[model samples]
Target: MTEKTAETKVTEAQRAALGLAQLSEDERRRGLLSIADAIDEHHEEILEANERDVTAGEELLAAGEYSQALVDRLKLSASKLDSISEMVRSVAHQDDPLEKTLAARRLDEGLDLYKVAVPIGVVGTVFESRPDALVQIAALCLKSGNAVILKGGSEASHSNRVLYELIREATAELPDGWAQLVEAREDVDALLEMDDSIDLLMPRGSSEFVRYIQNNTSIPVLGHTEGICHVYVDEAADLEMASDVAYDAKVQYPAVCNAVETLLVHEDVAEEFLPEIAARYEQAGVELRGDDATREIVEEAEAATEDDWSTEYGDLVLSIKVVDSLEAALDHITTYGSKHTESIVTDDDERASRFMRSLDSASVFHNASTRFSDGYRFGLGAEVGISTGKIHARGPVGLEGLTTYKYHLEGDGHVVASYAGDDVKPYLHEELEAEWTPGDRSDE
Candidate 1:
């Protein structure tokens, strides 16, 4: 693949998106299959490039410039590559997202209006650490009929280049510039300037980074910032189930954004639950910090500061707090939570319902781990990223998230002047169970 400037890429992507949007769903599915097939055929090449990236990442990690979590996300093995391929295939199999009528209504005697789904044109995504995100984002955009401009972390440069090139080559039969990979750090600045060309910007990073993007860009921003998630153990909870859920939330995979960062325990259960869960955390090499009430129960825990409540460790480190009631837990989470994901462990259905309904986070769970707040796990095929914001898409963003709707109005010899005249014909505005199709007439 030849390198292109950000301006050129964005312009090409705009044109390509128009062409891609006109293709049949089957044609788009075929393009996704090509990408999956390419991954299967060139798995070794992708891994070799990933190995080089991992080596460089290791050197940076040893120098203390990179976190272990960052390096872990940088490396990819044979199984990871297989998963990537399967992800693309799964995207292909998703029910078609475009051109489906969302709502239809009769406007007049021979006129009807329909709300139909359409692509968001060009999406520019800036993510860190995970090169696999490049594939997931690209496959989702292709399947949803949008052109994607992917800018992954500098740490995964080599791996991203190989994967982007493979995808671009694989989908050669489709529009040429459907997927554009921008490798330079400065390219992000260029991307921000082209709000007219790029319909949306999804940036996955720190709050500061996402804020910078939002502050600088006029384009609609879908920000995926820190995941300071919480797991609250209510007084009515089962100790065993609480232990299992909290353990998996924090220990199952602590490197991702959805992993639990803070643990809230009811004062009623503090004495009994603190020692039990702390032992499991300690055995897993997790560093635990707790409030006074918790430290009184678990002697091994370090003192947790106010800052610890809002931190996203993204590691095997957890901050614990003891709350007097479910309401206290809700107040603490509201003040410190990132609005990403939170779970409440309680056997009482009323308490669980209250917890699930009251929190403003993107995902809420009852007696389940925060780790399950994922797109693929939520049956979204795959996710571009999880949006904490309330606009457009929230939680795990899949093909549906990538789409926005258009109003398709079908009228036969109809004009607004007719409705303005003194002998105006009144519109019989009514909802209809109809799909939008060309040359289809309404029941006259």
Candidate 2:
């Protein structure tokens, strides 16, 4: 622990030879598609390796050191391996994000400002037992024109390593290094020091871990620190639809970031709605923790406290509060909610519109399950993380989330002096009358 083993660095020549993903977009997509084929072809070896990792993870579970749910998530299932292959195809065939010029302006007579898409260069992702993240982060970065270094937890190390091998072998067709896996847990320190090597770092797990990486690195991070999501059943809501959306949001996938952790009902509906919703949660095995007002209506609910309202229990746990008005619901959420994803199960267009505008969350749904806050559901080909933060990216982070734009100037020997000259009057700009369309270059 005192002195580290002699560090090895990628030599300039070695780095050039180790082709990661600096290929043409077509080349990158072909590489990723081949990975999907390889994964399907080598499914048995991957599963056997994953089984061994899960078996060892059982010891960690029996000691009460790790939750059984967490251990379960650590293991890859038959269907999930299939999902990885599907994601690879999904990302491969999607529209090219890099093809579009997001903005274009005539800066001068000849100097034109063309904002073009560029890669984040190199990425590092730190996540827990979710082995699928291996393919996700890799595929996302590759398609978006960047390389990635993935670090999955030790619980799923064997599975992760095997997956990495498939991706590496599949993407080896690239003349440039497109993806790399840092296998050892001890490599984390060197990872942090890789500000020079890595461009952006995204950590997906606990709030503490995300916060630690955020505080430690000066490199920009795009991720959610936590998922204390909420769902507010407004006064004008349709009783049946509201109940269905709320119940599904909380109970469908109770252990994910988008699962509803808190529910707020307006006073107009609280009396009739609380008991109805409580019964549904009971049927779904959800533990309802209610505030005094909610308890008065739903007698069986355990009393909710300030702590319960603020807590993000990624289990069958929910906190309910009764609000006198829509304003109160918004106020409560603005105060305690995690700014992750939230929804208003209201039929009234005005109310839904107002609530959507007022609530400051990444994805604000209207009469829909909060659980639908996902990449595939939103038609995003794949997602690296569900970002709750507001800076670079927010909501379901797909390929579009991982990149930043740089100004590409096409100048015909014109200088900024042309604009700075006293004789020159800057021409007022006008919108083009025709429907604006970016000419397709990716296909060409």
Q: lDDT of each structure?
A: 0.94, 0.78
What TM-score do all the candidates reach, one by one?
0.98, 0.89
Clashes of 2: 7
lDDT of 2 at 316: 89
Look at candidate 1 and give me any clashing residue pairs.
Answer: none
Query: Per-residue lDDT tens digits of candidate 2, residues 1-444?
Result: 453221232222125323432456787789889989999998899999999888888987888787765776777777888998998899998887774577766544444555676666777788887788888888887788776767788889899989988887887667444566666767766677656666788889888888878877777777656788888998898988899999998888777788899999998998888888899999988888998888888888899988997888888899999999888988999999888888998879998888999988899989889898888778788899988888788899998887777766555675656566778767433222221133321211
Highest lDDT: which candidate? 1
Count of backbone clashes, every candidate in sequence: 0, 7
Query: Largest TM-score belongs to which candidate?
Result: 1
